[model samples]
Target: MATPTITLVTAVPNPATFGQSVTLTATVIPLGAGTPTGTVTFTITGGPILTGTLSGGTTSVVASGLSAGVHPVVATYSGDNNFLSSTGSTVIAVVHASTTTSVVSTPDPSTLGAPVTFTATVTPVAPGAGAPTGTMTFVIGGSGGGLFTQPVTAGVATLTLSTLGIGTHPVVAIYSGDASFLPSSGTDTHTVIPAS
Candidate 1:
């Protein structure tokens, strides 16, 4: 007859940020005697399925790219010849990372009909790593100016314009955050003078 066995599972960094790596461990214990040997399969809800080989009744796997929410995890131990199979479960929570946006314009005070380039940069707050991806919206001169959208590449977005009447214009750069980062915006002002 096969010996009865029990499995237990745990997650390191229980509350993790989206796209952050997490370690999952599983331990299998035999009811009677002797250590349980074999492999353990981990099934993560909304994540990937991983297999780990047991060493001294314990095994671990590293996973990442989980969305911002609670995810269920299951560990199934493939019992050895003398032990019976067992399963264990756990949960992990992932939160969105905060971000900041800054905007700058080349030649802030420029002459009318002169080319002006506006650049926006997006960066993660503290305790977060990796570049943020998404779209950036450029709002020129409040509501009467114009609105333009550009894709964020390497955490930076830029726009250029040359048709400004002759006055001070307020410029805003809004970042449309992705699955891992939160949205943010930055503002600046540009003064346009009459051509010589």
Candidate 2:
């Protein structure tokens, strides 16, 4: 009779971001013996406990929706008939994700040479996540039409154009990323028709 020992291997990406999904993999190894099979339970501190069936001695699970902080994760292998149970652990740090950028152009269809205001709003992922401060590049009618920059104040930036070509213009607003927040952009269309 041979005494079987099991070794557990766990892998997870560290320094993750909030609302980011990551795959956690665990492998079970049997020392000087045959293959190991069964289920592996992955427990994440301040998160959820997930279980996955072992396929060819390997199992993986996707973990998401974690809060912003350091989370300790452990993988425990359920022993099969030929092997003993083992456990492995690791730590993951989740930071705040990038904020969202939403832009709106007033008077979508307006007469040429009229005033059009483009308002860009940057919203953080969660409340108290902090406001994003940077330059907002406003481009109208692609790259060649018009380009300008505005300072983001209190998660809001605005740009107004008094003159635009008489046609469909594609407006793009890009928010320059800052520390603690990633860059984001938004697009909208403004139609300028001929005056009566």
Candidate 3:
């Protein structure tokens, strides 16, 4: 008389997408002279267009091709070939490729040097949520954004260029995303209120 043993392998992706490869391995192996052979079947759980019957082994299939986006790869083994064997299964998720971030510049204030506030937003081209996790650099007249780095409760960002000298001071805000998102200002002015 013999007893049937089976174990499931966790820590695997679900519903793997198309155009990807996956591997199935056995786990929760009991300590003993367990029979290391039997009839193992590999199939996509709850998925269509996937079929195959594989042999038994501790670990099989270096990598198998699949469609994409979370393909469940199951590996099963029959314990009849050995004195004691455990049925094991694993799943792997395969997903499509991700494209690079595509961010554009928002309309900045035309005038430069003026004590005008502005907000530079970065948007990704992909159909996802949340803003791109990156830094938005704000530079002013060959100098760092001293106070510009200040946080804004709302969504808008403010840039204040104090009344320095005169000339056409260039007040620009550069957004730092993947590479660099620089939305510059044309030419804001700093009207020097004549000191009486």
Candidate 4:
């Protein structure tokens, strides 16, 4: 007769940020003597199915690229000839990652009507991994000034202009948060002098 077995599941960093990898471990314990030998199948709701080979009665799998939401995970132990099958479950919560934006203008002090390029770089805060995706809104010269939007490519957005009135312009770059990243903003100052 096959011996009864118990399975238990646990997740490291239960509350993880989007794009962060999560480790899932399944432990199989035999009700009777001896360790259970076999494999474990992990099923993640809204994610992917992973299979792991049991080692010393425990097996682990790494999961990444999870969207921001609650995911239910189930671990099924594929019992050996001497052990009966068992199952365990756990929950993982993924939240949006925070980001920081920094803006820079080339040719800080330039002549009026000269092309000036403004660049914005967006980076994820600590504990968050991967590049952020979304659009960037450039607000030039405070309120009522020129407003331009650009798509972010590899965590960067840029805009070029040469029509600013001669003076000091306060430029702000606003990042439009995506499903995996939170919104952020940065500022820069550009001075335009009469064509020299």
Candidate 5:
């Protein structure tokens, strides 16, 4: 009897987002010349046990609805008459997807050169998942469009602009995203009027 070596192959985007589907393929190779034909069982830590039939010494399965964290996966080969069983393991890191980000500018209609405060509020798709921690990129539109990065605190980021020209300015705030959340953005318009 020959020894069967099992290899596990994980799909791309290993640091997958929550609710995303991840595929795992296993290949069985026999030490001897004959091919290994049998069933492969896959087990995920804190997840489920799946089985796949090997055709040409290979089989695969998809995993979904995984929480945000590192998941340990193992593939075991059921040896046939000519081969001995073996197992391989790998780890997958899953993250959360951005839900929504809303931006609002105070003093929407204000005098030119007056300080205007912009606030960004970010919300995660899954409340129990975790809080989002990152920076927010603020981009202003118009003749005097400018951009700057502000660190988020408790899912909120703030920026103040005082050199805005007298016109309609479009403002946008983008969340740079962190390990648990994906990037997200929001937009709002600020109007500056001539000072009397």
Candidate 6:
């Protein structure tokens, strides 16, 4: 019996920024053994799952809408009675200067089922020394999703929407960028009223 080694199979981009998905993937290689027989379980010690799977000593998952912070991961494998657990975790930091972040949404109701102008206005932050800048994506209805990677000028980023379905449609604006520069930070929710 030898130490079971597990490697991260998931690619970590940045977990600190808002709307940034956290995916953890890893491959397990059982040393000094024949045909690894056991169940490999993946668990986010303190985060959410975005997308992933566990099978034949492989695990993966994605975490979404998670606040900025250091998140730990744990992978455990059971062997007979004595559980062989591996403690290999990563850190997830949410970028933000202050504890409270200001976010405003401006959803246009004129162009329902069509492209409309979507705006996300993030008010002056507490630590206003540096403002969050980068890509702010807009997803409307259930199918129409758009991208706006313009810098945040005057605390505003206008996202363009192509089309939205009828009825009350919910819209979300997520700010993504270099999380290391600024931890998990983003704006509030925006809504769109379908055409009558």
Candidate 2 regions with alpha-carbon error over 4 angstroms = 1-6, 100-120, 123-196
Q: For residues 1-196, what per-residue lDDT tens digits would candidate 5 score against the true structure?
A: 4665655556546877775777888888776676788898888886778888988888988877677788998898888888888888888888677658899988889788889899999887752245678999999998666999999887899999888899999988999987667889999998999988
Preferred candidate (TM-score higher): 4 or 5: 4
For TM-score, the strongest prediction is: 4
Residue range with the least summed lDDT across 10 consecutive positions in model 4 = 138-147
lDDT of 4 by residue, 9-127 (tens): 99889899887899999999999998898999999998999999998999999998889999999999999999999999999999999999999999989788889999999999877
Residue range 1-196, candidate 1, lDDT tens digits: 9999899999988888765789999999899989899999999999999999999999999988788899999999988898999999999998888889999988878888889899999988865657888999999993236899999988899999887778889999999999889999999998888889
In candidate 2, which residue pairs clash?
Answer: none
lDDT agreement with native, every candidate = 0.90, 0.79, 0.40, 0.92, 0.82, 0.50
lDDT of 2 by residue, 128-188 (tens): 2556788899888832268899999878899888778788888888999765467899988
Clashes, model 5: 0
In the order shown, what is each candidate's alpha-carbon RMSD?
2.7, 8.1, 11.8, 1.7, 7.6, 14.7
Ordered from best to worst lDDT, the candidate numbers read: 4, 1, 5, 2, 6, 3
Query: Using lDDT as the measure, which candidate wins?
Result: 4
RMSD of 6: 14.7
Q: How does each model score on TM-score?
A: 0.83, 0.54, 0.35, 0.94, 0.55, 0.39
lDDT of 3 by residue, 1-196 (tens): 4445564544323433233344455543434544444545555554432322333434444344443445455655555544355555555655443223221222232233335444544443332122333444454553322324533221234444443343333444443332212222222322332233
* TM accuracy, model 4: 0.94
The per-candidate count of clashes, in order, stands at 0, 0, 22, 0, 0, 21
Q: Give the better candidate number (1 or 2) by lDDT.
A: 1
- Candidate 1 residues lying further than 4 Å off, grouped into runs, are 126-131, 142-146, 165-168, 193-196
Error of 5 at 25 (Å): 25
- Which scores higher on TM-score, 2 or 3? 2
Summing lDDT over every window of 10 consecutive residues in candidate 2, give the lowest-scoring window: 2-11
